[model samples]
Target: MNNQHDPLSSRPLVSSQEYSEVKNEDFEETACEDSITQRSPSTELPAYKLRRSAWYPDMRVMISREVLAVHLVWLLILAATIYVLGRFTPEVKCGVSRLPSDVVFGDIPYQIVNWDEDSGFVNSDPLDGKRWNQSREWADSTDWTPWDDIHPGSWVQVAPSSKLGISGGIPLRDYSKDGSWDTNDEGYALTMHHQIHCLGLMKHVFISAERNEPIPSTSFRHMDHCVEYIRQSIMCYGDLTLEPLQLGSSQKAIESDTWGSKHFCRDWTALKEAVWERSTVGFDRHGFVFDKVIP
Candidate 1:
């Protein structure tokens, strides 16, 4: 072909190898662009661009403190609520709800009688000398008095023989083998009597045992003396109504007669009625109602 007139020679002539190399270079550039476009945003983005301004160390610390403070405030509020509820709640009272079936002994309410002038124990040492001698002799004697003929003062006559039984003798003498006086034994007896007297006085008076106040030894002794007087009267009169006797100058003796005559002797039937009235017939949640019955 003539170079000046040929159509293929009109444009710049390229080698076959050069054209192939140019096509391959263009394909390589396209593949590099596609790989860059497909890469993850995290790997492609700058560190500054990926992190927010609010997520800086100082800002993060401030946010954590605020969250912690909110939790602490809520915890404090909950604790305070619990404390208030505990402080204001009413206390619950516990006790037995039922009455007892056993016979309950209680102190009979009696007025104090002032008969100090006529007490039989006044200036008389019943524990020693002539009285002691007589008592000792009487204890050995075999003379017996019928229960029907017994009177208020008759306890003195029957006490010697009755002492052989469980209930009649002074606790100290009864506990001793030779009937010797023991201060400790006497104290123990008095303590027992005091307990019994307190039970009698408080019987059926309180709905719950926890509500009852402790009885003082002095008060127990006073009540015991009064009951002892009544016991003597019961022993003597055998339910007979007798005039109140002058028991002597001792306050115990005088008070005994005063209270005993009014409660035990003068109105013996009434006393029995009172006991019946005070007794309960139902089952008890607590233990026995009374420790002992005086009569």
Candidate 2:
């Protein structure tokens, strides 16, 4: 058999299945003319341009309304700068960090100003009234003591049986049941010399306490009404009984010339040295002072 021209019938016809059947008949005639140019509805898109660039708005929609009006003008300028810094600021306050006063005041006798007016209290007053019975009867005839060199308005005398001792809270009456008045330390120095003769008999002088007894001419008229009540109330008045001086070496007492003739005063050693020098300046033992301060 003479193989017809051999090499698989002369190898010259290229095909790949006739070039895939003419590329599938030219892609079905270009999809039938692109579906007759999209069904020929005037050949394209239009119904309001197929309505959509994000449903009709443009330049990135005014760049999203200028980014929401610049985030609502930066949230209304941060809420009007926090309402104008809460309507014009300024309320800070803060204080309290203290510790520095030291305490000074010197000359003292009366103007203390605080810590309860140094203590004697004249202000909040009331601690057994009549201004503490006229400041303990004007400190019993303007108190004085080195055992009694009587000084301020003097007129000493006192004696519900002497040796003074009525410390404040007064009420130790029983002047032997009934004589009502007498409360010790010579009936509290004759009720503080009748409340210093009701505070206004001017030039101090009090003396009244001779309920009876003792002589040397009524102790020289009770020592001449204590040297005419310290020579009509202070500023000067002397005579401290010349001699028997020594107060400690076992106590002694015999120079009593009484007030006017000076010397011999001891309303319990002048109200215990004017209640320890008016309670060490702050004035207490009834003078009342220790002022006050408390936020």
Best by TM-score: 1
lDDT of 1 at 282: 21
Q: Score candidate 2 by lDDT.
A: 0.34
> What is the lDDT, from 0 to 100, of the residue 288 in candidate 2?
24
Which sections of candidate 2 miss by over 4 Å? 1-44, 47-60, 63-67, 74-78, 83-295
**All candidates' TM-scores?**
0.19, 0.16
What digit string (tens of lDDT, one per residue) describes model 2 on residues 1-295?
2223347676443322222221334234433434423232232333443454334457678789999999999999999987665433422323211111100111113221211122232212222233232346544434332212221222221222111221332233332233343434221233233334333222121222232433345545645665566456553324233532334444674343322333334344535345333221112233321211011
Please give the lDDT score at residue 174 for candidate 2. 31
TM-score, cand. 1 vs. native:
0.19
Instruction: Estimate, for each residue in 3-48, the C-alpha lDDT of model 1 and write its tens digit.
Output: 2344766654332222222133423443334343433322133345
lDDT of 1 at 106: 28
